[model samples]
Target: MPWTLPSRPSRRSLLAGAAGAAGAALLTGCSGGPGTADPDPAVSLERRMRASSVRDSERLLERYDATAAAHPALAERLAPLRAAVAAHTSALSSSGASDGSAAPSAPAAAPAPGAGPAVSGEPVPPKPEEALAALADAERSLAESRTVALAGAPGELARLLASVAACGAVHAYLLTPTPGAAS
Candidate 1:
């Protein structure tokens, strides 16, 4: 008989075994299955709110980044605003509210900073003035959303949201062009 090593279990079998183990764990509630409920509804609600705020902040940052990329002239002006949004996202994520179970859905798409209809994927290059205006509008909207979420947040989270809202408001104002200003 030819000398041959015993055939090892196929790769598919290994993957199946691993998946089966994971499914068993989930079914047994070892990883907080669907049957599990949060101990405190209020806390759960607060976490959801925080997660939503983080998602909004992240969307705002993406808008800013897209605008800056399309119109390099505005990059310098948008840098600080982007930094502020990034800080808000970092704070919210670090607060333990970004766990997958409670994380909010991401925005469907980030619109280009332009007057025409929003296009997904490839963004239309926008003029500097229009881009800035769009960025300001996005910031204002995010700030409003954050303000609404503040009511449900814990003390520390509330304070953080308040500061983030204030910063967003300031960024919106700063992004607006002054009358008679060069484009």
Candidate 2:
């Protein structure tokens, strides 16, 4: 047989190749286009809830600090509770981040005296007994809020919220004044 060089690909073959490439690009593009769109509603809501929880934790920590500072005797009791709030703030902040890394540590110093109320605009109690009652009330409120938040949170976040609720409940009990204690 006479030797023959292979002919270049035909126009039809080149057109078919280009068409296939275009179809593939279209299919992939349809999956996720370049436009910036909002995330799923559920995911957005969950993120907002996480941010709210972090803010609440920060306020609660500030309240604890103010109460402990005003009444030096209460400092020992409030220290652990404050630490727990800090940890909750840390976890909530980190878990909500896109990168899944821990947030920066909060400053060690507590807010200055008369900074603000723990929740709402109510003033911090002036007396020790009143302060403890206020703290307990705040803890109970936080626990309740956490319980509500858990229902909508994703699996890991739900678990974290539940644990935080349990801790808040315990803190509430510890803050409650004894029957015979001065009021």
Candidate 3:
């Protein structure tokens, strides 16, 4: 005989399921089976931003680990960036608005050539005297992301991402070197 679920569960049971689902959705958006209320677009955008931030941080950490392990000379400068990226990942994870995947595993730090004198990638390498320039670019893009997220994000998710975006702007500033200083 085919098993069939009860056509009508008790009201209390239904309410409990709803609350639990909501909580699960909040903690790990889309983790529950399909048909949950669509998350606000802003929330979706924020989740994307958080994921991007996590990835970027991981890359930075890998770079730092490689350089710190081999060159040691650049550790002072790269250490903070690595720490910041790790913190960014942590913040994104705790935002309670993640896309449900566990944080990306820390990659083995290979001696990938540092993003040299040339600017490569979206955020650009916050390095060589152009660090600030790179950060500005990242912030500008992140701002755009924030605007999108704000439009669709709701409640705590909006609040957290907004706060994180502000911090990202600050990070951009931090990445920039003082005037006339060698990179």
Q: What TM-score does each of the candidates earn?
A: 0.61, 0.67, 0.47
Cα RMSDs of all predictions?
18.8, 24.5, 18.5
User: Model 2: runs farther than 4 Å from truth?
Assistant: 1-39, 96-100, 113-120, 180-183
Error of 3 at 148 (Å): 3.9
Best by TM-score: 2
Q: Candidate 1: where are CA atoms >4 Å away? A: 1-39, 96-125, 180-183
Off by over 4 Å in 3: 1-75, 94-110, 113-127, 180-183
Worst 10-residue lDDT window for candidate 2 reads: 21-30
Q: lDDT per residue, candidate 1, 1-183, as tens digits?
A: 897653543445544543443343333333334575665884776678777777777767677667765666676877777777777787776645446454433333434444233332334245777767777777778777766665555555666666677677667767776555585
Model 3, 1-183: lDDT tens digits are: 998765544445634543443453355432435565675765676677666656654554454454443444556765665566566557655546356555534444444455333222233244334444544455545644653454445556555555555555555555555555475
CA lDDT for candidate 2? 0.70
Cα lDDT of model 3 overall?
A: 0.51
Tens-digit per-residue lDDT, 1-183, candidate 2: 997644544445544543443344334334534563565875777678788888888788778877876777778878888898888888877755568676655835765555545433567788888998898899889887877666556555666677677677767767775454484
CA lDDT scores, all candidates in order: 0.62, 0.70, 0.51
CA lDDT, candidate 3, residue 86 = 62
